[model samples]
Each structure stands twice: as C-alpha cells, then as structure tokens.
Target: MRHLAFPLLFLAGCTRTADEPIDYDSLRAEACTSACAVIDTCDPDRFAGMDPEDCFERCSTLLPRLQEENQCGSREIIHLECLGKLTCDEFEQNEIGSDLSEPSSLDFDAPCVTELHWAVECDHKEPFNLDEPAPTAP
Candidate 1:
C-alpha cells in the first residue's frame, strides 16, 4: 500500500495539498486494513483458531484484486471502501467463507455491494488444497 507519508512528509512538508491525486491502490490497501482489523477483533467466534497474522497476510494478497476491473479504473474507490467498513455482525450474518448457498439479506448495491467481480478461474485436473503445496503449472 502506498503511504500518504510520501506526499505529506516529503512533498507537502507534513501537510496535505489540495492538488494531490488520490492513489487508488493506497485506498484499496487502507480498505483491506480496516476490514482485517475488524475481523481480527470483532469476530472471535467466526475466526476461531485462526491467527490474526494469517488473516492480515491473506487479506493483503486477496483484497487488492478487487480493483482489477474490465474497464480502466471503472471500479470506484468508494464502493471498495464501503466493503471495508462492513460490520462484524454483517459479516457473520452473510456466512462468507462457507459452503452455504442461502440468498444474502445484505444489500450488494453500489452504495455497498456495488458489484461482484469474478476471480480468474480454470479447469484443473486436481482441486488445489491449502494443506498441500501448489501443483506445478504445465
């Protein structure tokens, strides 16, 4: 995540300038931080036996992918940030990371659930397991 420190400390002399452009990457990173913090603290029962470090590490790798839209910069930063602000109760209610297929009560609209981006997927001979090492690409 790009730190605001660079612009604030070095360029702006510890103050922010109006003309400074917002870095979307940094915004996405901050969103991940907020989300991760909430999960690490607010959802103990949900994440039982999980290390907070693992959550931070996994979230760092995964959350940034939300910005990779088909159109250049089409995905808005606000929507991504909205997801970061999701409540622990809401997350628990959603039953994410589970195999359950019940329709969600949460509004996945522009203000919050603006859009769902599909991950890059492919047909593999074997299902990848986290317990085991990744299969070698052909």
Candidate 2:
C-alpha cells in the first residue's frame, strides 16, 4: 500500500501559500490504512479446523461491517473470507506457499489477501504428525 505519512502531512499542513487545497492522496492513504488494519485483524486463525462452508459463512457475516466502517471494500473481502474457510494444507497449496512473510498493507485486496490469509491460516490450523506410523509386528 502507498505510505501515508507524507501524504498525511501534506494534507494536514495545507498553508495559505499552498497550491493544493485537498490532498486526495492522504485521504486515499488513510482509507488504505483503515482497510488493511481491518484485513490484518480478520484473522483466519479464528476459524481454524472449521468446515470450509462454515468459515465462509462466518466471514460473510462479519465482513460487511468492515466494509461499512470503511475498513475494507466489499469487492475483495469475500475472497479472503473464502480462503479463510480452507484447511491449512489446502490453503497453503491453493492459496499460498510455505516460507511465510509478514503480511503487507497491500494485502487488503483479493489476491494478496487470499494468499496471506491462507499462509497464516496454515500456521494456525494444526501441526502435522510428528511421529511415524506404528509398524505392524507379525
């Protein structure tokens, strides 16, 4: 996501000699910040081990509020919600890969959110079997 600090200062510091009255850039940045924060906290971990359909159902109920609050847009939230519904391996293979990275603010959108949601989701989903299958002794 575009950084906001510069734009925020530019907008808030409009001066008598300033040529630009309104800083759409800052406004957009603020909106993005709000959006990403909403996305970040909408942790798929909450629904770990849940059935896919159920996870989607729960996220569907909650995301509208995030949209209304200007935390995220309606367009892409569904994808993240859908991804949240997937199992860890399912999520990793289909939605993301292993080698997890800190999620970026840019992930508020569909594709990236889907990826990041699932990447983190896998970590929270469940641990793999550490023990080998027991051998059958004749």
Tens digits of per-residue lDDT for model 1, 26-126:
64566456555655565544435545435545554544433443221223233234345556665443234221132243233322332222112212333
Model 1 has an lDDT value of 0.35
How many angstroms is residue 4 displaced in model 1 relative to the true structure, after the best TM-score fit?
Answer: 28
Q: What's the residue-level lDDT of 4 in candidate 1? A: 9
User: Which candidate leads in lDDT?
Assistant: 1
Q: List the residue pairs that clash in candidate 1.
A: 108-113, 109-114
Question: Model 2: per-residue lDDT, tens digit, 77-112?
Answer: 323433434444443343333222434422333233
lDDT of each: 0.35, 0.31
How close is each model in CA RMSD to the real structure? 14.3, 19.0
Count residue pairs with overlapping backbones in model 2: 1
Model 2 residue 51 CA deviation in Å = 12
